[model samples]
Target: MPYVSMSALLAFVLVYGLGLGPIPFFIASEMFEVAPRPAGMAWGSLANWGGNFLVGMGFPTMRNVIGPYSFLLFSAFTMGLFLFTKFYFPETRGKTPTQVAQLCSRGLRSRPLTTATAKHIL
Candidate 1:
């Protein structure tokens, strides 16, 4: 690839990866009914870092094992996970703790909160 093309590819990957990567954990926190507390936040952060570390630590071996096409598979899996979350995860905002817990536990789909839901909850 040309220099400009390479730069564009790099930028695209950076933006795309950063934008969609954290979503799984954001959904997980809701799905798991993690309380909005310091400890909960700490646990979430720990989980995120742990995953990051595991991937980073294994990247070289994975790259060698899978070759250049590994990233394509990785991206595909990431997008699949995102789509799965979008379809299955319940929105948690504006819900009481009990409601959130129930939604998470029962897998009951709640419509995502709008301004009206925010107003009602507030």
Candidate 2:
């Protein structure tokens, strides 16, 4: 039991440290070009901290109301975020901002551009 608990904690910490913790700071900058990057980053930071504040403030009341099932609520939240990211977030690492915006603007599912379309955008 202890080993399982410790392993789960370590796994979560590693995932958070490597992915969640750092991604927010840079992702907004990538999403926007020079003109609006600062505003985008500021808004993103505010949303991130606002969410943290809400979760911190609400978790205790939620736990009391939901009891052991409180974790289920958070699990559901995590799953929703996972699905949102997987479905809505574009792969921006190699894409230019224009390309990223075009890909994202298409809606729920994004498609790969053909050579002509890619050339037009890039």
Candidate 3:
């Protein structure tokens, strides 16, 4: 790859770190009830760090073994996560924990929230 291409690719981490790095933490915080939130956040942070460590420690070897295909592996995983979130993850903004849990349990099949449903749930 050319210098500009390499630089552009490497620059993504800066953008991600600045713009999107806190989103998972925010989501995890919002997802749990008050009684369990501390523990939940701890576990979630641990998992996040574990996954980061895996990528940081394994990426070089993975790249060596799979060459350019390693990026495809990441891309596929990201796309899968996107689809999973799109389908099953509930909107938690202004919602109580019970509502969020109900939404999650109902899975991807839950219909769009109407004002009546929202009012009733609240």
lDDT of each: 0.70, 0.77, 0.75
Candidate 2 weakest lDDT stretch, 10 residues: 104-113
RMSD of 3: 7.0
Tens-place lDDT per residue, model 2, 1-122, is 99999999899879877876666677687777778778988988888788778988998999889998998988898888865675468788788888876765675574565697567645
Predicted structure with the largest TM-score when compared to the true one: 3
Tens-place lDDT per residue, model 3, 41-95, is: 8887777788779989999999999998898998898778765665457778888
Clashes of each: 0, 0, 0
Give lDDT for model 1.
0.70
lDDT of 1 by residue, 4-120 (tens): 999997997698578855654565555444455455656767777787788789889989999988788778878887556555677678877667677777754546767986677
* Per-prediction TM-score to the true structure, in the order listed: 0.56, 0.66, 0.67
- How much does each candidate deviate from the true structure in C-alpha RMSD? 8.4, 7.5, 7.0
> Of models 1 and 2, which has the larger TM-score?
2
The weakest ten consecutive residues by lDDT in model 1 span: 29-38
Give the per-residue Cα lDDT of candidate 2 at 67. Answer: 93
